[model samples]
Target chain A: MNNQLLPERTVYLVSDGTGITVETFSNAVLSQFDQVRFKEIHLPFICSIEKAKEAVIKINNTANETGYPPIIFSTLVNIDIMNLLKTANCIFIDLFGTFINHIEQAIGHKSNNSIGRSHMVSDSEKYRNRIDAINFSLSHDDGQFVNQLNKADVILIGVSRCGKTPTSLYLAMQYAIKAANFPLTPDDFERNTLPATIVPFKSKLFGLSILPERLSEVRNERRPNSKYATLEQCRYEVSESEKMMRREGISWLSTTTKSIEEISTTVLQEIGLSRTLA
Target chain B: MNNQLLPERTVYLVSDGTGITVETFSNAVLSQFDQVRFKEIHLPFICSIEKAKEAVIKINNTANETGYPPIIFSTLVNIDIMNLLKTANCIFIDLFGTFINHIEQAIGHKSNNSIGRSHMVSDSEKYRNRIDAINFSLSHDDGQFVNQLNKADVILIGVSRCGKTPTSLYLAMQYAIKAANFPLTPDDFERNTLPATIVPFKSKLFGLSILPERLSEVRNERRPNSKYATLEQCRYEVSESEKMMRREGISWLSTTTKSIEEISTTVLQEIGLSRTLA
Candidate 1:
């Protein structure tokens, strides 16, 4: 068997959230190597100190079985939990280590505590920017906020029904960005004016627009019988969104249609927020 | 200001499906260079022939605007579509080149003739294994074939409330593993034996066991009032599941206190999938 060719190993992924992103990262990175066979285990939703210890015990047991060693991938693992993991017979790869050091160096801020996940909240004030970005999307419809849009971490203005929600969520989850999206509406057509609020943020403003037919199909799924779902209506909306963006000199994207991941990464790349979300 | 310092570039991430993965790659890689100011225009749903032309138009416009010339970070962009963007004033970074070359050389496969967003589904049988791996995650909850346990890319055998579903889905999506899960019901625990069909696939098997308290909490979330969520019941089930795994010589992971990402990544790293998915 190939088992004789490769050594057996174990890997543990620890995280602040569900370890979803960390898992994805670990899989992507480790899959590059095929010479080793690993035994993987998921430990989700361990939100306290006692739970971390429980994990440590299980990991210790796993190491004993592997007869070799293990690799632990942890994201935002509390120091106490990390220490507990240290007791296990293996190597630990902490993703948060560099980030924490970056944060401390970037802000010259000393962490208030060293034991728990509480340090993440020390800069709670920055979270409002993300909330505001969400609120900005909710309040600003289409090119209305085009001019002030420069304030956005990443301004994603798209045609109605373009895959915006998923892209936004992906960016937020992956890179911790304040991604704000505003959809181009019918009114955006007649006036074709970039919103005053968006004027200041114009530099940061980016757009997402899709094809008429694609937009219609997506809309039709939600409201099948309405004129809004009709091809003619879709054509008009697409035209208007395009015209409005052009009039305001706002260059936007056409998701008409791209996969959510594609659009998200593209958007993150275009705007400076690529660094934030990635 | 710095727009001139690092000319805003356009990186195309063309894909079928959701484009979530490749897009993240583009963003992550690019974001590392803080000095690079790029204007990303993501084209999703490039699977369509029509969307191909539209993508070209956007590429043209962005290249003209970003005067220093744009850089297209394209993933899964149709080569035909590339024809349109090729003439645009930019440097294109093609993602499919290496992958396609690798496949052609290794698998002797004829690439699929379909349009824009289609992944490299080769016409040759040699590449079928890779395609199977890629599409593995799409079919989950195929509960009809418990007897076909051997067919699974990965089989998760664990007690209930041990983070199985999410873990299964993660494996499928990340590794394209057709993961089928069978919960070790209390009856099995009481009997201390695995399902009869799982005996042959013991090598491909993985077990998840959660600590009694954690299992109780997880179960409580679904069914708040029950002996099933009780610490005593959890202890009994975990003990029985462990005993069965030990008797069968199947390796198991403890889900009692780890995150799902950690679990899935551990598996991906252990079994080895692909670099990008990790």
Candidate 2:
């Protein structure tokens, strides 16, 4: 047996909501400790004292079985439930308690102590804006809603499979930005001019380009052995699209090495769109 | 002037990649202190020592201007760059350093120490899976791809405007789960049975219902004064859909008060789907 195999520990993600915040936060912290194996137990929606007691029993059982104190990462807002959970035979990391106290002290006011408001669609205006943005983006994807170009906060133009759809959707979902994407086809390349449909909204247009090799590889996954996926075709499309963007004085970014998050951030920053949901 | 108003603090989110990890982490932490205002500065793609120096200068300037040291929350992986950032006039919260050290000691191995791998699409299989899931979810949204029901990991059925599309997209994007959503129409309510297309995938079906008043309010915003936007119609559809779900032995939840994150998590857990991406 390899002695280097680190001992395993139990980690519980306890929350009153879906456990997303606690899970993501714990994962970010645990990711730093790559050597220790973790058995994650998610105790979600533990809002009541009874549920908290059940969780404590489960945590104690795990500690007994493992001969090590389990680590509990909790985002519970109810003080009673949090106090009950502290009774478990584990190293309780109250992820929210200390921070909430600090914040309350700094603000000189008590929080509403509401449960599960972090992701709630509580505000009618924000909810409506998000829903509207989602519907608009879906309808306008891949050059489908050219007639509605004026509705977009930003329009993304690029060759096929250049991270346009995902970035647009991210911007819409995360920030309620009305983003539309249009594909530049071979015909557009031959014309060597901005599409007539998008010229009216030139200022809102952004271009995404990718390395020809990467574009070809991405396209080949969906349409194998086709002209659309050919490296030569990819090269031509990228070259022409960059030229068109330059001539039109539209800013562009390459998506070759960037993730969807990176691409969306850059697009929002470049277009000066505020993140409404954040 | 309101004496209770807390002074604002300057907070920096620094990372080598998309800055998503640090941004999300800091936001989650800062959200607890809602009374204390914050001015967020995002320094993304800080991969080199030169860029780190520039960030240091900016941080120091903020400290001087604010008369309080800025709070630097960083996820830097490079030791040299991390060390250089320490020179900044700020309260440095080394988000990754101590954890890396703990992990190194436990694992008896060093991390790859590579920059910007958190959001990298370096693994072709994972990237392809994510892209495929996105395409599949989009095509199957809103009862569009009934013929492809068998391909879905989970199928969310609900009345119109029950937060189905955004939840499906979130599942696909965050977990690489092929989620399909179908809307139950008035005709389906009259028929009083599961749709023919989804009958074969009964085990994979999940139901989303919403409060009738809230549903009507949501629909009224889109199509005012229509029968579809009537509270009576919403009540009928929600009642019928819940009955159908019960008869079919499919589990269900209400999206009236839950966030998209909560809805997605419940669906995945109820359907026994493992999260493929973090």
Candidate 3:
């Protein structure tokens, strides 16, 4: 079915922090309803009673105008504010409150219920490591600073525009993994070997290849109608890179239709790095 | 209470996708219980019944060894696989199942219930924009490619090592915001004005300042004992940058104690950009 022709619904992701957790949860859940088109609203940093009341008013107004109750997925930790938000004219899903009680009972301790702790810089050492990883990924991007390639937890290799840079950044930002990406140019294909700098870190290598059509589309956006962006060049580069990776026995995947999250997860899984989610 | 003195718990985040959503939700909920120490295990991309059974076995073994039931937060969509996982000796929290039924009742439609759809590149246009944003942020980082600064949705201005780079990248990766960052170097501070290239786009500028001590520590990591890494020099740069931003009437914040997610959200909010979370 055409997504536009599907039924429309309004959904709100309300939280006292950046609203990222609640938004992620709601998006995953709502993606299951492929037959519905959702208009999402993010009401983040709603920690106080005043903010909660304002959200309730906004949610109710949306409901009144749409002639249907909006759905609210909230991670508000303040009991009073959560109670106020629950009074809104919507199907409220208490993401935190529902689990906190059960977890408290199981653990034999009451939750502190303070707001905005999840994404805070509570552990300065861990936060510092994440920042360091970002800096490492940035400095080592696109095969630059190859002398320091030994510091990378995972080094991604692929043809140009085959989903290396963004995936590297995501791995660094989300997992605090120091990721370095090297682009496989025509010279590397001609050599028919991994770069000398990466030869020692074979276990740290992960390869990403893309479909030629998608690679051409992506490249053409930057260099329109150029020989460099032509479909034939893209096809040659992708196939050569894939053959090279296979010959070297390096684990790889095609990133033609995958999201950055998926590509990063696959790379981590392939490289056997199981980091706790940041 | 001292966190180390509290009871330890074993928790598992199981999913048929990247496990990011469940991990995010579980982290936020678990952070509320500061008294409990958690050892987290992530089992992602578990789509088949065999994987589900394996996860059950792992959870049961963990429970037996810990002498307590492990807590399981799962987003498995397949009914059969979810039922198999539920048989484990653990506090099974079905994150998706708990909400899908209510949402179905509200919308009067059964969900598609497919696995791994949430983080897939289902919408090529949106995914392409995110990649473009990432590329823009990279090319425009730290005052490079300022000739195209007009294309930026928000330009972050701050002293060196004041949390500008990571925040810019996070905004681009997470929200697809074309964020460009320029360091407020000693040259800009000596001139006592905003950079000439940014004068025309003052309205798009947001400033980030860091505590001098923290800035010194961060800079010390890169260039130890250098004059630029001294706390006294850091104070001068931070104060001068703040004075310049104030004189230019740009919205600014202190990143001394904030996370990258927090800084990005605040920048978006201050710049009046309400992008849907990707």
Model 3 chain B — which ten-residue stretch has the worst lDDT? B269-278
Where does model 1 sit among the CAPRI classes? incorrect
Best-to-worst DockQ order: 3, 2, 1
Pairs of residues at least 3 apart in sequence or in different chains that clash in candidate 2: none
Q: Give per-residue CA lDDT, model 2, range B133-163, as digits (tens).
A: 8888999999887777888999988888898
**Candidate with best lDDT:** 3
Weakest ten-residue segment in model 2 chain B by summed lDDT: B98-107
TM-scores, each model vs. reference: 0.40, 0.89, 0.95
Instruction: Tell me the lDDT of candidate 3.
Output: 0.89
Candidate 1 lDDT, B25-128, residue by residue in tens? 45434433444465555565566657767777777777576554555655443567666656666565554443444423332344452333222222223233
Best model per TM-score = 3
**Chain A of model 1, TM-score against the native?**
0.57
Alpha-carbon DockQ of candidate 1: 0.06
In what order do the candidates fall by lDDT, top score first? Answer: 3, 2, 1
Rank ordering of all candidates by TM-score, starting from the highest: 3, 2, 1
Which pairs of residues collide in model 3?
A: none
Q: State each candidate's chain A TM-score.
A: 0.57, 0.91, 0.93
